[model samples]
Target chain A: MENSPKIAANPEKYTFILFVSGMSVKSGHAIENLRSICDTYLKGNFNLQIIDITTDRQSAVDYQIIAIPTLIKTGPGQPRTLLGDLSDTEKVLRILDIKS
Target chain B: MFNYFHKKNQTGVRKIKPSKPQDEKFSFPKTPTGVEGLDEITDGGFPKGRPTLICGGAGCGKTLLSMQFLIKGITDFSEHGVFMSFEEPSKDLSLNVKSLGFDLDKLKAEKKLVVDYVRVERSEIEETGEYDLEGLFIRLNHAIDSVNAKRVVLDTIESLFAGLDNQAILRAELRRLFHWLKEKGVTAIITGERGEATLTRQGLEEYVSDCVIILDHRVIEQVSTRRLRIIKYRGSTHGTNEYPFLIDEDGISVLPITSLKLNNEVSSELVSTGVPGLDTMFVGGGFYRGSNILISGTAGTAKTTIACYFANEQCKKHEKTVFFAFEESPQQLIRNMKSIGIDLEKHIDKGLLQIHASRPSLNGLELHLLTLRKLIKDFKPTTVILDPISNLITVGNENEVRSMLVRLIDMLKANNITALFTSLNKQNDNLRPDLAEESVSSLVDTWITVRDMEGIGERNRGIFIVKSRGMGHSNQVREFVIGSKGIELLDVEFGPEGILTGAARKSNQLQRTVKAMKLQSDLDRKDREIDRKRKVLEANIAALKNEFESVVEELGILKATEDLHSKIMIENTPKTKKK
Candidate 1:
């Protein structure tokens, strides 16, 4: 409804957190880039929790994320899950059900 | 309200069928601003044929940049342009830009450019019941069509905003204006005075949100420097840097401070900076032809002397060179350097070196860079010298100076030209001044500092290499001397005390005190002479007083004799008065 350049006025719906390993040579780049995309598109709506499983192997198991690189939608009502580094935004959007 | 409801009820309504949404693609020609740094930052000139919303504060070079944008499009890009001025007339625009070598009126006559001045004086017109901007639109269209304009600039929209006050009509007209620009499919610039964080006074950000560029002219430390920043571009990959820009007789040329590249390839060819001793400091005894050397020191600390020696070396090496003197004129500089035996005149005569001396204040920093750009392009010299770049900071702020240096260094490096810069530091306690221009220091391949060291009885000049990137250079601070023959690199004098600063002459008071004591002894003899003169004056005063008393006594006796005579006469007169 609001038309300011910063038009994402609604932030209460989603809390998405993205976890990252660090800016390393291999796996870190994927995590870092994914963080920027989430921040840019989701803005305040989605909080990105990027847990670096490369460092803390226990956290992945603790969150029941068995896959090495996995994204678990921890919100209520049929929490859809996805695998891989979240590179493909379309597939990620389908998994997260983000409106265009 | 009841009458409207009854009328609607009497009419009754039927739902119309919904139409399918259509996706229509349209293409618009984009006209690049051609404002130097702007095009680089925006990544290849602004989208040609699209209207860019350039808004910023007053005195931010809005009108000037817009005009330059149009002028460059005409002159450089071979594109036709239409300039619609809401501020000044066509004559003023031409006059104002004539200094820039942009013959606006000539271009107009040549049918390459067209300018229409919409003198929107509020007093000239009477308001009608319902009006439109068709007249203004027609005028703009006529101007555009006449030139077959590929570029158009609306100097300012606020002038019309002030002339008209009907909010509804103004809003509708402004929207129509932007849409009409897109409809024309011509690249255009609609400049507005920025209000708050919004794009324009009318809040046209949402309306023309396709692209936004902001121009800012800030006076940091009393020096006005311009910077252009791109806020948004709908579909473009652009560098986001608030780059320093300059306005001069030419036009707005921005200094692209940081180009995104990390190619640090060191050249193999050893180029001497004309000074053999200084060259010996580097491991290779020279610099990569394009290396930047910073010779910094306090006044008379030999910053310029060191740089002259370097320039002299290049000429000796038979390299074609240009020295951009920021401080002294060519003749004066040559004379001073001649005293030190650098003899730049020889190089000038040989046509091996070119001395282009100018006051940094003569033009803005970017203009200086641009003139350098032009000179470099034409001369294609292998070596260049910016004698005392610190002077540039006076015309522009520190940041501007730094950015200018960055771009200059990049240009020199990209061309593989050896560059030397002299800096006169003011009362710097630290070996380095802010060298906030230090940001460019990293970009430089070599950093040299000439400082004054205090020896026991005198000050000696010392030159040291602070850093030379990708090459091993001398770490030792070598004492140096400038003499009639030329500059000689004195070995670093090592004693119990570390180093003596140069120009420490006449600093010790021991010799001064000895001279003062000798003067005091001479003054003591003068004091005796003053005493004799005081006694003589006292004696003369005493003698004159005694003489005066004696004369008084003599006068008293004479008065007694006169009184006796007067008494006799008075007795005789008194008898007559009684009758």
Candidate 2:
């Protein structure tokens, strides 16, 4: 588990950072929607990091996440930011440049 | 970095506990703008730890106002501030405000200020994917943290819109930016270009900021004036009128002239009207110390002369006076007063009197009031005189003039300064039907009417105390003469036709002298006739007495002759018969 074969094999996997307000309705919706989209589309090809802005304000400031439910594609060719709840799976996939 | 965040979070938790009560209504404490006459209109200042939008057209002093706010915050309240410009560079901004006497370079060197210039060029960059304004946030955060700023100004943030192509993203980012500033606990001023139908070009007022101020510059009758109005202030009450603001070498100053209330302290001390006879009209020596006196009359009725006398009297009492001459220049007024023996130049030379002469048409009514207010504040005069306030009627309507005079009088009363205004009435306006006079008459504590009494081939000036509030005043219409010795009220004259004056008085005196001479001659002739009659009657009485004496002598002689002829008995009988 600590050194999984997929993580070890994919050296240039997609890196994602999801910023959310703690336990909010919008944040909960965004987390569920993003998980289904990433799990179904990226399979075992992405690395995701979830940060709660209430607890990790420094990381939020570092990433410059102003609004809640912000998703950052850090490992992509160029960094892309998507705002609002990630309820639209097709739009999120296109914004993240991922294929199912 | 993780540990630093943990430490900061701990301190933040502690800070949040104490600030919870302030969050009930989300009522942010205010930060004083420190601009003259601005905080009064804003009811303290802009909201603290929140964004304030200042929108105006080009060259309306939006940047200057914001700069003054930031600089004054640092200098007056000891609160550090940061100015981030998206339009002009820091060097140009510093130079621009240098004329206003703001030493931005020195303040920066002292670590109390930071001016950051953010340059955005659309042609230099291409947008491909979704992104945030991280660069701007980082720059602003770094600048604020370096100076520990409590205030911030983003002058003309709409320039970013001009330089950026993504409107949806910029709008979202700006909303979040304002929230971010609130979270950072810094008072921020965001300036923008005014839109056709919105408060800002980007409709930034939709973001729900704490305050919104709109500046308007307009040219009326070939005179440009800048007016400021607070469209909205969330948590505090503010003045609602459009206040005229002026930008001079000292920066922007708003004149909240009508914001003053009528509850200022009043004085009971009396101040003479300078003309001794006029002072005798009031129950007190003259008007109340802080009272407003209006002298209304037609042209050449000595209205300015009376105002000059009042000002001269104040100066004579060692009290400072400010005389606003709207009709005549200072030198011209001095020359005219000299003819009436009012030496105003003497007081001016002694620094006890300040003469501010200007044409009423030079600017709008508000500008005139503002100039007067500035002069009064700087001179700290105990008395103020506005000669021919009627001239101001040309600049504004009746309502505007009334409100302006009300404010002027209220300010003088608040400062415990005596004020006298001379108004010109129309020719033959004996009923005092002038609109300006009618409007301000109720606001004055004393009202005097001077008119021309044209009768019997001569025109004489008559002064009457129309009303004196809270005191008894003379009701007699005293005819006054303006000569080399100033104004002197003549004694009341009475004739069959009523109060006599001019030629009628002279003719009445002549008629009285003729009647007295005719009465003296008639009495002397009657005395001579009575003396002649008494002399004739005395002569007749004397003559009768002589006859009686002679008859008695004859009777005595006949009795002696009869006594020789033995007629002693007959003589005794004749004597008995005579008895």
Candidate 3:
């Protein structure tokens, strides 16, 4: 819902913002994949926010988003952006520097 | 953003209302770019509401051209624009265009322009699975709607190919992007880097088929020139020739006038050649207004002098004049002309004349022509003079110089500016067959040649009109002197050596006067001798008549003596005979 990912309230809390187009099959898979990965890896230690760019398109511009299902992990290290449906959970974790 | 495209697909409806019925039947709608000479080449401008691909190599002015289009649209046509830069950020773009006098910041503040910097960093991005460019569409739509922009510029959209992965998905997304832009109904320009094989690196020309413009920067010898060409404009007829364009402080100006047709309007009005005698040589007393006149000559044959005279004459008439002096600086030209009594400095001070002097090697021939074209446009001169166009030949080969001259002459003629060009030929070369003369002589309305007429070990300047189209020009070569009083064409003289000039002419005149004087004295001596002979004969006849009278008197006396004894000789002798 937020245009920018909020600063982690707790310094160690993993924060992620996922941007997607409205109701597309790829976007649906990306949302489910990210939730499952966060649940399995960090359990209740992470905050996840999902935004449909079709509705909050202004957020997409502010975030410099180009591809759909883009996930930005802003925590534990420098922020990193991930593209596509996030179906390759291992590749997404490797890019975000998350050991799972 | 998805709904916008989805709604259009479901209804198969165009977001833009169809153009006026008659307009649709006649011609496709066009949005004028308002760039100088570009609207003429496009035959109006880019196709309205369609994507146009502008491709060129790096530093070939592709971005500047697109920026000019957007700025000109807003400033000239009052249409707002959105600039989506895949290369430079908004701050950098503003700084770059500010040098060209385009205040992008001001335009943004006024809500007339929106610059969206789309940064796609490869290091920060990870491809997981299937994805589309819906985010780009969303950002572009938001920017366009914010300003209600009618024009959009996606400068070098090829940068996306570098940032994104998966060619199939990217290609499909690009297709959808173009379609979405069409639905938005804004005239859009998509710039691409030139490809080795295709028009664009990503072959963007394949997607944007409505119009394709290519910009080329070529360096011949050591000079570089920028040229523009319209490869295609689907529904409109456009000028397909490669036109030289200039990027100065004012932005991109394409020189689109290469008049292939000889159908320019002719003026019977005469513009003096500045030299009265030269004007008189043309039966009409001067050149036809708007006609091209070429004066080819050997070095020091007063070619520049004649050109200056023409410029001075135009300025005297209070008409503007632009003198492109290739050989001499303005100060030097003004000083040189002053020696011949032509005070060009005054005309310059009066703002009636502009002397632009540049080295021929400073720029390519195309740049020279572009510069001249710009000067003519700004000055709007009634007369234009290029002192020694031969210098331009040094920068380019014969064909290039000829083509440039063709464009230049056409531009001048179209503007109805009387054009005079001076060409310097080699010292011993025939003036007719040299580079400048051979190329431009045929295209000009008047071709005048000045040469060193060498006679009796002295050289004299002689001028003659080689050809004058549609006028009765003198077929005589008149000797001219460049005295302190300017160019004075002497009366045509035919001597024993034929068409004598200068010192030779003066010597021949003296010889003629001496011969005439000798003949006059010889006639006087012959008349005195004849009068003496007639007086002597008259005296001899008078003496013979007196002798006859005396003899008759003696005979009468003798007859009277005998006739007193014989009736005075006869009468007395006759009376004696009767007694």
Clashes of 2: 0
- Please tell me which predicted candidate would have the highest lDDT against the true structure: 3
lDDT tens digits, residues B1-579, model 2?
Answer: 353356346545644554567646544468999888889898789988888999899999999999999999998999999998878988999999999999999999999999887766555333333445644665677779889999999987787787666687787678778879989999999998899888887875434466899999987666677899998876567898888888877888887766445688888888888886888888786898888889999888989889998888899999999999998899999999999788889999999998989989988887787787787778899999998899988887787788888888877887888889999989863474688798889999899999998875689999999899989998888888888888898777888978888888778778878988998898888888888889999998999999999999999999888777776667657866776
Give the best candidate by TM-score.
3
What is the per-residue lDDT of model 3 for residues B23-56, given as tens digits with 9 covering 90 to 100?
A: 6566668999878889989989998998898988
- Name the lDDT value of residue B317 in candidate 2: 93
DockQ-derived CAPRI band for the predicted complex in model 1: incorrect
Native-to-model Cα distance after best TM-score fit, residue B318 in candidate 2, in Å: 1.3
Question: Against the true structure, what is every candidate's RMSD?
Answer: 31.3, 11.4, 7.7
| Pairs of residues clashing in candidate 2 | none
Residue B411 lDDT (model 3): 87
DockQ of model 3 vs. true complex: 0.68
Candidate rank order under DockQ: 3, 2, 1
Clashing residue pairs found in predicted model 3: B559-B568, B559-B569, B560-B568, B562-B566, B563-B566, B563-B567, B563-B568, B566-B572, B567-B572
Over the full model, what C-alpha lDDT does candidate 2 score relative to the true structure?
0.82
Give me candidate 3's TM-score against the actual structure.
Answer: 0.86
